[model samples]
Target chain A: MKRILARISYDGSGFKGYQKQPDARSVQQEMERALAKIHKETSWRSTSSGRTDAGVHALRQPVHFDTTLDIPEARWARALNSVLPKDIFVHECREVDSSFHARYDAVGKEYLYRMTCGEDYSVFKRHFEHQLREIPDRRLMQQAAGYMLGTHNFSSLSSPRTAVVDKVRTMYAIDVLKEGNSWTLRFVGSGFLYQMVRVMTGTLLEVGFRHRRPDTIPEMIAFEKRSAAGKTAPGEGLYLSQVFYEEAALQKHLKTIKKP
Target chain B: MKRILARISYDGSGFKGYQKQPDARSVQQEMERALAKIHKETSWRSTSSGRTDAGVHALRQPVHFDTTLDIPEARWARALNSVLPKDIFVHECREVDSSFHARYDAVGKEYLYRMTCGEDYSVFKRHFEHQLREIPDRRLMQQAAGYMLGTHNFSSLSSPRTAVVDKVRTMYAIDVLKEGNSWTLRFVGSGFLYQMVRVMTGTLLEVGFRHRRPDTIPEMIAFEKRSAAGKTAPGEGLYLSQVFYEEAALQKHLKTIKKP
Candidate 1:
């Protein structure tokens, strides 16, 4: 049995999300199906660092799977990409020890949210962007984003869809940068709850547009209730950027990965 | 009446083309309808530098429209963008002299054709690119492109759909640049015939892929017959980049540009 790590990218528009479902399309299902074709009935299970929602995109999503196929590591990428849909691609694939787990072994996750303060997006970029007609104040958005960094009880800023008993998460940093008619929010965190990024995006957008006070960040975090945060931003503008792992720990984890 | 020149961009995946067709959803038809809403009860004439086929995209397609409404020139861009579909946008609008014609008065035109030599494209960019499983040789393609530069009878390299009687035209230059998995063919010319760009791209692709030799270029030009060139490339990978005009000519066109 050999463990493998793959860096993937996908357009999640037609998917239910990253996880498998009984009757829906998903990144995991597609990846598994592609792997099955290459391995020829070999059982394979994939674990990802992030399970983004439908319509969200991924620039650098990392996943690990275990298989007993004898193919060389170099052939794995070409093999998988040959069958995967054009919207999903494996950028890099390599063999690793069996102990690596894509999700449990992650050290950090980074997400990016884009906001366009215009009526329309660049024709070529429409699928990856969400257009908002109202203009937002950049300074206020930046101020609000700054307060969002550090450890916080983010119960109020996370979606209620998931039952996360402990809502405390450490946000290493949050940066809101503006350029012309667009704004990008980069979130670096140890981990996140369900829809946490989108919820934070919405709150910051409200602050930028003057609908909420910049100081509302503290109250919202302290509230520890869903209603205290802003609305959920649209899924189209979100992207799962990177999944980081400690190299020393990763090597050990890869040894126990399962194979057919 | 005022004449205005607008720089527009569109994802042609949803439209029949840039021209207005009686029963088809066209970029022109949509823009006309949207503009008519602002200039109620007024019929306006809009013209583009050229028609881009369905599924083709544009980065700087120039258009001219005549109107009699009283809206400011600066507001025209935002106003039209608001009513346009998410895939199309009016990037800028400025009053042009009465004599300015988007097509006839242009001094130069730039077009770009993108092709990917990979199994899959970046999910966000799939719609804007054409995938070619067989990688083409760039050096050979560049040699063929070199033969295509300068004055020539392009009738042999154009599609039968072209409506022009004169086949002699000058192509200032053709630049083939490769970036990672994608190859971009950029053409600068005085003008292009109907389906000319698509056919040119096809012939170049054929040569690049070794289906034909670079020497075939001069032969095709000498043949001066439409059947001598390669197949027509798909519209999905083409873009009308920009239109250029002389300052004096632009001034004359601006005077006739309509308001609102």
Candidate 2:
């Protein structure tokens, strides 16, 4: 058996979520349906690095599947794209060893949360950004982020319904970038608990707005309860940017200052 | 009765077209429905600057309606916006005399046609651009635009289904601006017939690709037949950028050379 890995980008507004449910539309369902049509097999399945919530977009999500067909490796993307809807695109695909697991082999992941504090909401950008009525203090948000840069039990920053038994995770870096009226928060972590990124962003935004003190982050983390954190930011503004399987690639992904 | 004119922007991918039809979803239907709900009248109607085809977005389309409600001038936009769908946004509004009309009083119009030549199609841009596989020459397109300036009967550039008897229209300016891989064709004219801007863009592209000569534009217009021109460009890349009520504003819209 041969395993093939495909990197895809999706506009998630048209889907309910990335994971498969019994009654709702999903990206996994569409991927499996395209595979079934290609292989003429009804029980075909695929495994992804992680699942994104409803209305969350992705730039480079990877998935792997085993098949018995003799089609060329590069041609898999074109063949699958022919059957998939326009909302999803398969841009790259390659063959992988049978021992490679798409989910278990991941070493790091990156996420981007975009928030905009414009004079008014934009019609064209209603699908991809969190709109705020007032501007937040970038310095306060940066100060709050410094407390979350190391290993900790993130029980306060995750949903209680997450099925994981261990909530301890390591944060590699957090970058705050501001351009015009929009602010983008970049998170690099070993792994994320369910809804962790959104909760952290929500907490940091509160700190920026002066609703919470930046020094409160340590107590929020040590409380080890979900109620200690701020609200979970909406899924519309969250994006799964990349998944890394190697330490070298993860280190290379960090942003470096440029000399003009 | 008081007349109010509103400037709106919409993402047309969610609607069938801009005109009101019996069965299909339309921008007109949504606007009138929002008005009806706001005024408690089922017979509210509106008139627009012009009609756009299906999948054509608009940045600053204007519309007017008469109402007996006592809502303040500035608050009308907020009231209607409260009920309108997210895809359509009302950005500006003002009170006008009853003599001023939205459709018949228009003096000039500007439309933009955006096209991109990329190595592969982008998934995030499936709603707004015309994707091309090969790059077209910019100099050839500019040379062809020279034939389309000034007063002339643009019969070949309009659709045969246009109901207007007088097809003579004055062309003021045609600016072809290229930034990176994308080309923006801006058209400023006294007025346009049905599908005229799209057909003109399509013909210029054919000239850029060497399928037609630049000097052939005169003969194509003199032919007085729609078949004499090139293929009709799709509606996906077209945008109703603005409408002008005065000659001075129209002249100011022309492209001016910048001093670096």
Candidate 3:
């Protein structure tokens, strides 16, 4: 059997989440269903790089599965897309080493959180962007994000439901991009805890609102408590932009991404 | 009661069509439902510039209604938007002259049709753009469009179900914009028969595909038969971009619209 790694994209509006669950519509369930049809009587289990929450979109999610079918790389994408729903799409597929685990082999990840504030927010993007109740100060948000760079115990910025004890993670980059009334916060890290990106964004927004000071971020991270951070941003605004396997490929892939 | 004019926008994916039907969901039904709640005892009837077919979107569709309520122009949009679904939106509102009628007073209209050819089309735009099976020659398409400029009998370019006796209409502008793998065609005309824009786009695309010679366009217009032209493009790719009242406003408004 050959292991196939595929780059996928999906609109999360119609899905419950990325994970498969009985009686719930999900991206994984739909993908595996397509795979099952192509594999004849055999069942093919797929593995993803990460699990995104409901309403969270993905532009380039990587997934791997083993199959004995001798389909061409380009034909695999075409075949899979034909059976998959319009909301989910397979962009590219390639044969990979059997030892390459989609989750464990991932060296880094990148997430993008979109936000719109004030009265001029886009009506078209209501499902895709977080609409802030009040306009926040951009400069203040930028200063607060700077504190989140590098290695730190980000337990305060993760969900309390996260059971893993190792909270220390390296944040390689944090960028705050501003355009018109909308802004996007991009995060590149070695790995993120559950809801880490959302909580970090929410905390920085609180700083922008002047409810919390930029210097308070350090103490919040040091406290290692979930209560130390602000409210978590909505899942609809978050996106799993990329999953990096090779450390050298992170910067090269980032340059290709454009502003929303 | 004052006649209120509003510019509306909607994503047509969830809607059956623009007109009110007995059972199916429509944009007009949703708008009127919101208006009925605000009017209390009295019912306000709305009239649109044109009836768009199923799955057809609108960027700036002008609608007018007579209302007894004394709500401010700004508040009118806000009030309606609050009651409407996320797919439909009220962008701008104004209290127009009492004699103004949405359909009768309209002098001209603009329609935009989007298309993408070959394999590299955007996956996210499946619901919005027409994905052509084969790549078309753009230069040949442009040459065919030139024949469609100025006043012509467009009976061959509209649906056969059209009841209008006079099919002659003046075309002010016909622009074909190419960007990457996708292309957009914009049409500004005095008036269009039902499905005229979509049919025209299909005919031009057929020219681009080399299925029909560019010189045959004038003969198609001369024939004045529905079978003389190419097939009608799908409604999903069509948009009612603008409805013009004042003759001078057409050029001014056209300049403001950006490419898809």
Best-performing candidate as measured by TM-score: 2
Candidate 2 ranges with C-alpha deviation above 4 Å: A255-260, B255-260
- In model 2, the Cα lDDT at residue A245 comes to 93
Better of 1 and 3 by TM-score: 3
The RMSD of every model to the true structure, in order and in angstroms, is 7.0, 1.9, 2.9
lDDT (10s digit) by residue, model 1, range B59-178: 868899988887889999989988878778888899989899988888877788988886555666667887787888899998999999888988888876656788878887688888
DockQ-best of 2 and 3: 2
- Model 1 achieves a DockQ score of 0.54
TM-score of 1: 0.78
Model 2 residue B77 CA deviation in Å: 1.3
The two-chain DockQ for each candidate, comma-separated, is 0.54, 0.73, 0.42
Query: For residues A1-260, what per-residue lDDT tens digits would candidate 3 score against the true structure?
Result: 99999999988877889999888899999889999999874456999998988888998799999998999876999999888888888889999999999999999999999988875445457668898758898888889888999899998999979668899999977888888877899999999999899999988889989999998999999999999999998898998998999967976765655333
Fnat computed for model 3: 0.34
User: What is the Cα-based lDDT of residue B96 in candidate 1?
Assistant: 88
Write model 1 residue lDDT over A1-260, tens digit each, in one string: 89988889999877989989889999999999888788787545788886999889998688888887888888888888999998898888999878888888887777889878865556666667767878888889889988888888889889878866888898876777678987788887878899999999999988988999998789888988989989999898999986768744433433332121
